[model samples]
Target: MQQAAPSASLPERARGVIPGGVNSGQRNVPGLTDLVITRAQGASFWDSDGRRYTDYHAAFGPPLLGHNDPDVVRAVAEAGGSLDLCGVGVTEGEVELAETLVELVPSMERVLLTSTGSEATFHALRVARAATGRRLVVKFQGCYHGWHDSVSLNVISAPDRVGHKDPISTGILPEVLDATLVLPFNDRDAVRAAFAEHGADIAAVILEPVPHNVGCLLPDQEFLVTLREECTRHGSVLVFDEVITGVRHGLGGWQEVAGIVPDLTTMGKAIANGYPIGAIGGRADLMDMFSSRPGAPVFFAGTYNGHPAVVAAALATLRKLHAEPVHEHVFRLGERVRTELPPVLASLGVPAVVTGYGSVFVTYFMDRLPHTYDDLLDNDTRMFVGYRRRMIDQGVFELPLNLKRSHFSYAHTDADVDRLIEVTEAAVRAQLADEGPLTDMDGTSTMGGATRC
Candidate 1:
């Protein structure tokens, strides 16, 4: 791949204008200069320097159907040309989208649309508290539920800091952090202990049904079943933060896979195929709290909650996802990447593990796949940075940080996967030859050059 000239001028100017030379911190890939994307289509994006690369990140999991999908684009443009925002009123598109969602996820009887995943989660937590009359909430480490202060605790924190709760942001009040409990994911014992201590006071236990942050970590069947039973026993609401995993995993999500239902499930990202939209839906009884009655205290309102354009896009995306059987392609593509990529890394004597479900997964530079944020932190960071730079240079777009994960979409083909794997293999070989072996931040080589699969 020919090296594109670095466009440092815009980012340098942005440093003084924008807070972090970017709107979102996640967009700022570390080490290499930030490449500003100018245009995107199916499975690829063109940076400001006119370099095209296969977009494996998929805009952090929203582009399930791919960037600028023609169907979604047409829907959005047609809807926006007429009705853009119909606040507080029932639009035909909104109603149809809601109906589509309810039919797709049988667990979701009623759906309330919002603008972003964070707002959906915030509103869901509020509904849970109102329904249960409890103040406490529980979440697992490494599971990011957007930027809300409540769910911001324990996300991607250092492993040495485990067992002690830490807030990701400074503005989050100590009282708020106190109200939210942090626990290790895939560990029923930690959840059991937390419930034993403060189960009665807990309003909800919110978690990413399939955690994609800090590398993809899937929960065990027993762990999910135990959560359902315990939440039911304590009369606490179980909230599945399926913002990333919702339609990406399947039409039904992890709940469908695990055979357990959550009282409330939050969905975003691919729900609208890159359009900005989020939804919280589940049992009708719990969702009834959002009723706009004259006397009801519970309030959930957003000016653009069900914007017509987004609704139109969502309805189109969902219909296409189901009608076209996108999940089958996603699963097939995911299997190829996960199975073939690990051995390529191993052949180069690079220790790494590919962990995740469906099309969204992460290649962690570790020996054993991580179970907790602590375990993830024990993996190689410098090696990941090096590999990311090399992969990017080789026309593959991946998250440049160790803690962050990569995503794939339905738009990806076998050729895309092969290209990505080839570039990854080259990157792994380069890193191993140049750096000898990858080591954790603490300079440990526990991650022997071996494949966990």
Candidate 2:
């Protein structure tokens, strides 16, 4: 191993070993990653430079109760004293967490825990394939399930590749790409056509019910119902990839809110409130493939699938959620942002649409809001990135990337939201003054020949 220079900056040192000086591609924000975070508590994080910023990124939506939440911290600490990985058998914490998930998530009758959302989705697809004895999977273009090769393609693809197979990374086999069918979100006819053409081959239809990865493209209820009906008719498993939407939206997830149930649901991000935990849950018959029986086909094995401290943290987070009005507070603040931010931008001649549900938001530089990824093609990518970058400069931490949604935590208050709005106005004003001519005839500066970065 090599060592960084004693005086070298954190990012400078990190780029030497870590790819792009970040672990995840989403964390590779141009300006935001330059500084290393020192610590975070409540609704803000402090950088190594000793500057505090009100956080809207929320560690990509994991810190729903906010960074280093006291309740979660105490629970983890307590668990650490008495409980560690035993590996041979299950712990009480894991069982309780699973029980809590089954009780809360409307669709989950049985549950399996994994260490990350990627693993949960991987297990989910595997379970679906094993259950249906099918190879092909159907995913919406903008909804990102995870990094596994099966569903890696077609998220935030370039304009030319909008409706085609465009893998985010190399090394994914062409056959793997071919096995997954990607379609436009909120397009009921497209979904129906795909089902009509190849429903029998599709093992599962997986999507983020709200499609938060490409900024919230709210699902049409009819489109969801269509998927449910089609998958039922075809014997294909219907999966809701709720990794981003899981406990953040509600205890029952978006499925409960939408009154639409899926055969399988993958959860993470906010489930444990910043702990390293992920879960896959669904129908008992389907999940039984991983049962510890003499002839169970699916292989379900993990050394640290449900680490005690992590499960304890999750249980504590849920307790706080049940005891406090977390959803009510965050939802009200989120609604305030959605209602207040747009008109403020419009007044500044910055034609933008703020889109999200509950505690997430994204300011799209477009006239009308989007219903599908195709509708987002015309969004001003340059301006979208620029505005977020500007917000970061002004001490409001919006991820400086196009199409990424901002997350509000339970720690955020009315004052924090007020600061966000004030900084947002300043950010837009600064961008318009610097860039010049930010609007087009249709009220959005089009991306126009530029690729999504």
Candidate 3:
């Protein structure tokens, strides 16, 4: 590893003002001081000390078109009319953005915008409760719905403590915890059991159809079908939190891919090409509940609900995604990684599972592909973290968390993917030096391994 430069002092100085020297807990790398990033463009960013890295973090999925996409930048610039707090109704850009969203998204009978995925999820829950007149909500274990009291339980915890009804953060009210019922992902029997027992009281059954929080675990067809059938039978609203999967998986995300429409959907991340925006869209009747025209309203409002310039950026982003081969490029690279990375681990004798869909993927040190979050608990977390540190040293940038998923955007090239493969093989060799290879398969393929690096 390189010696720490004086530039490291910036984060130390930030600690005096910001708690933990960062705005979000996820940014705090476990075994190393977080780098202070100075600038970013296209598929790479440089740290404060001028260290360059090909970024796979993608700001946790906001950079769908990559950093500073000129289309989004130009749109924002053209709409340079910044003071969007125009408390007097709506802007043309916001309306255009909303229309684009309604057209592209499967469940968008109506649209409501917010500035963050957390707020969108929170509002979606409120609509479910109000529409169904129920109090309890069912969320999957380890499927993060943001840091709100309603859905913050079990997103992160020690392995032994992960599959329970514990709150992920402190200061959440007990009532909030009680109102949320946490269940394991991809376990059909668990969902059936929960719905059977609390069917009458379950207002919403919300999950990330593809759970990306605790690594990338896909849904069993039976599991998703069962969610739809059971929720319909029990009169509970089904909500797909597609904040990370949206646009990256497809225009409509999980809904479009799976062909199952949730009553309400919360989208962000890739929606705005890295701009700050979130949207909740669904059936007209349910969304209309937000309007107090005749009856009571659901109390959903935000100051930056549809900031003009941000909306323009989102519009341009959606247009580019619609008119371009964005998905083709992302899925091609993603499929290459999925096909090739397993052999890399196999040759190194590292028992692991590489899981993902579309442009989001995660590497887990496990015996097989994880069926649920519980399945991921038995691996060597230290080895994974060590491998991540080694990859950083090799200039392949990823969030230094042990098991966070890697994200990719349209800006990454085949050459960048070559660097990713090279760095990954080196990291595996460094961290798994004494370990034996897990599988008998070939691992000498020079293949793509970019995405959530």
Candidate 4:
């Protein structure tokens, strides 16, 4: 795990050309030198200097079967050679992909293909508003739906800013901000209150059934049940934003795990096994809003919506996931991660909480697992961020920050999990030994030994 800064000139080169030296705002962890990864394969990727990392980033949760999975790659290549984009009528691949989704998802009576999860989610909200004739959307705080105007408020805000309509991005209109009502996750009482106040005017209640965005905070059964009951009682569409969790749990996604059907579901990430694709599916009557027969039809069209190569990749990905015990394997790996890491932290006197479900997990800097966004405010995030950088230097690709989830794919072997625990222990010990006199993960002062990343 000898370290080298990634091609030292790359960051300067990128900043000269790209905004913030990156396309996505979150391309770099806070304290690390910016990197340019050169190649990726199963369960690992390499930086510009040929340093290989056991990748848990999973391309931010798309590569469930891991990078360059043979079947998905083959499907994409074959389709690219034959027909990649047919800008005419539908192809069998698209139709077959949709059919596969509908068959797998219990509530997918109808389906729409889109280029990204953001598009799928936007259209889902559109369909909900169109069908219900309501404009208000109820979303949980810290639950990120997408980059669209409607769903972009209150994502990972500071402690005092909870429930405030502070758009995380600039240029979001006041009206768009006004249309969204934010609440804390796992708060059934707040759900009740919001619905009681604005149920009649609410178009949809959207959230990740298990929120991966904020360190994998889970929905209490009561919380989820209340959402379902209230959405049903109020005629509001329940939209599950399963962009990260979709199909990572199973063939049918988190909805299958929860056993509660959302009125509409937006899916991406693991849906295509790293291919660029998205899908929105739900009840037939509501899904029909996109049809031409409607007088004011929801205009859901994208030239690349059903791109053949990506669709073929998605179909092949689904085929592999369905025909194999992918989830079982990954779930066990996830369990191994959650189970194994804490002892190392405890033995080294680092206070931390490890929480996750299925294949998505996070190592929080807090002493206990957090229940709300505000609770995360006091966490010694500086410590965890440094630990993650050390882990990267040890050739592991956990994102070097708090609040970002670590994704384990089916390609992660038993050896990978063992290596993960080993490196994490080494990283924590090294981090602790380098700096002196800082707070433990419990928010109490301790003799520290680590320098900042």
Candidate 5:
């Protein structure tokens, strides 16, 4: 195959070959469709046009230690030099990594490794079905488990599609959609109703615990407790999809903070600090369903399940996290952003709410904070995306999309947070100056187009 000519722009040439000129659909920013990153290091990435951006997107919350950290790079290099894939046997790095996970995460008596968060969730669901001998899986409306058929539906749904089975993609079997029950997050009555009607057939109740995908909807303690209690009473496995909240929130994951232990926990993202690694850990009895021997109840196999270099990266990241004041620093910076941003927004006459846990923040363009996916319908998507787009134009790299979380890494400094606030103020000023202040004339945002939900 012939490659495109050197004279062509990167995005243009990429479009000739790759779908949407990007590998992932999420990478294709809404208005800024051709944004191309060249290289990244500690808290910032350079664009193809030689523009530097202080990164808060953090590659969708995977680069917890920041991009291309020296420790992770060095560990990966050393492991690559000495170890290569030996598919039949586990490497020492893999065992040590698994041991660290089991030791750190709250719900792990046994662990299975995969290469992506989606794969981890996939295997977790399989294990749940095997353990319970049931077909129904319960998930929250805004909580995204993965791209798999079982749990892909009902995230970021349109207003018209809310409270319905709205699959994020096509080609999912109707039966798969029917088997998965989607309920509103933090709604105890809906949860009780689901279990009350179909408790006997419920295989699992899975959630993000925080639902960071919708820009960090904090879980109500009562809601989480209800989920735990219902899952226990119904003999259904409780699966916490902590792929975004795992090591990023703390070494023990969100379950540790929430004081609720799920039967199975799927993790990734911050685990390897940007490396391609994912894992599912749970009660030994349920996890033991997978075996390499014949007639295993659940078949779990991946060629690169425990790649030596990735394992080395994970170990090094975890070690650095423990050795350094990582959580303290990032959490402080996150708090600073959350605290400082509201004043800036208010000064600029932008009605917004800032909310997140440690090392994460999100700006929701609404008067009040949201507790459920239905409440998010009030979010002015126009102002949300407009403000972020303006920030990106000023070289602050927040993903210019609605309902996306902004992340902070260990490499970020107080200076970065200040810069973010400075850029945000300027962005909101420029937006308001260009377009008049918000009005309820048509019951929608007049900044851009109609409010999209």
Candidate 6:
């Protein structure tokens, strides 16, 4: 196996002052810990120690176009010199982005801007409740809407807890879980039963149209159609959490692929090409609930909502996505990776499956592709952990946690895919050859590559 680059002691020392040695909890995996990143460009990143790697994590799914694209940087610089924040009124960039989004997805007649995907879902849920006058919300077992208490339940919960409908995280009030109903994915009968039992009380059914949280599980055509029909039959709103699948799939996202229009759609991550921006979009009639009225109790307001810099970045990103054939390139690159990577793993006698829809994909170590979170739970995590470690050592960066899916960007080329597959094959062979402690390497304890709160 390859040796790791010299550790960045500065970040480790700064950890004494900065809690957990990182700004976000996701950045700090217990045994697979690393310090601050020094720089990133295109599909590659360098750590503080100057070690370079092909970045498959892609900023946790925001770098659809790639990191530090010249167009996005130029847009940010221009917008930074002028208007940065627009608290209430509309800006030219914001209006342009909103109009472009509506044109891209005609089902979205209106949109509400926010700073993060979590905030977008939070506001969308409120709008649904206000419009339908309902109290319950239904979400799938492994679909993650964001960090909000209401939608945070059942995101990769254990099999036992999932079967019992228990919240995945602690400190969430029992009442919050009570208002949220959890069900298995791709289960038409279960969804039908949910609508039958709480049809009158369900305000919305929120889910990632293409679930990526647990290894890019795609729903069947019948299941997508069932959600559309069932939501219409009952008065509940159907929400598509396209935060990860928004532009990664197509200009219109999973809605276009599935051929089903939802009542509301939440988008983030790549919306601004790595700039912090989120949008809640849907039919004008339902979105109008956000307007202040005597009887309307829904309130959605933020100081940084549609900030000019982020909006300008979004406009530039959208323009690039439209002006260039980015999606076509993404499809070509995706096909190469999906086609070439798996067989390479198999050649090395490593059990693996490459699953994804469009530019985003995951390398899962399982006998077959998983259809649900339960299937993902049964995967060989030990092998995955070993493989991930070897990949890192071989200068390929994926999410240290195997459970969390990795992503690809338009910046990744055929050459990048070739290098990744080559390194992955070597990594697997190395892992299979080693008999060392699978739990520890180089004095760092491995976290088993499992992601949880």
Q: Candidates' lDDT values, in order?
A: 0.81, 0.86, 0.80, 0.82, 0.87, 0.82
Off by over 4 Å in 5: 293-295, 436-453
Flag regions of model 3 displaced more than 4 Å: 1-8, 81-83, 292-295, 434-453
**What overall lDDT, based on C-alpha atoms, would model 6 receive against the true structure?**
0.82
> What lDDT tens digits, residue by residue, belong to model 3 across residues 1-453?
535456747777777568988887767765445578899998989988888888888888778899999999998888875555675588888788778878888888888889999999999899899999999999987788987898987775555566567776789999889898988888889889998899999999999988887668888888899999999999999999999888888887788888888888998856888888999999898889985224648876788888887788888999999999998998888777777888888888888877799787778777888787767676556566667777888778777664678877899888877778778888978876745332101222211111111
Please write out the lDDT profile of model 4 over residues 1-453, one tens digit for every residue.
544457748777777677778888667455444677889999999888888999998777899999999999998899988896668788999889889989998889988888999898999989899999998998887788889998887776655566577677889888888998988889999999999999999999999888777668877888889999999999999999888878887777788888988999999856889788899999999888796335648777888888988898899899999898998999999998899888878888877888888888888766788787776665666676667878887898888645778988878999999999998888888887876544433444532222111
Q: How many residue pairs clash per model?
A: 0, 0, 5, 8, 0, 1
Using lDDT, give the best candidate's number. Answer: 5
lDDT of 1: 0.81
lDDT tens digits by residue: candidate 5, 1-453? 888998988889989999889888788766666778789999999988999999999888988999999999999999989998989877888889889999998899988889999999998888889888999999988888878998988888778888889988889999999999999999999999999999999999899999988898999999999999999998999999999999999999999999999999999857889899999999988887897535777888999999998899899999999999999999999899888889888877778889999999998888898888888888776677767888888889888766889999999998888888988888777766765554322345444322322
Task: Compute the lDDT of residue 240 as modeled in candidate 4.
Answer: 93
Worst 10 residues of 4 by lDDT: 444-453
TM-score against truth, every candidate:
0.92, 0.95, 0.92, 0.92, 0.95, 0.93
- Report per-prediction Cα RMSD to one decimal: 4.7, 3.1, 6.1, 4.9, 2.9, 4.5
Clash pairs (backbone) in predicted model 5: none
Worst 10 residues of 2 by lDDT: 440-449
Off by over 4 Å in 1: 1-8, 291-293, 436-453
Write one digit per residue (lDDT tens) for candidate 6, span 352-407: 78888777777887788888777877666667767777788778987766577777
Give the clashing residue pairs of candidate 2, or none: none
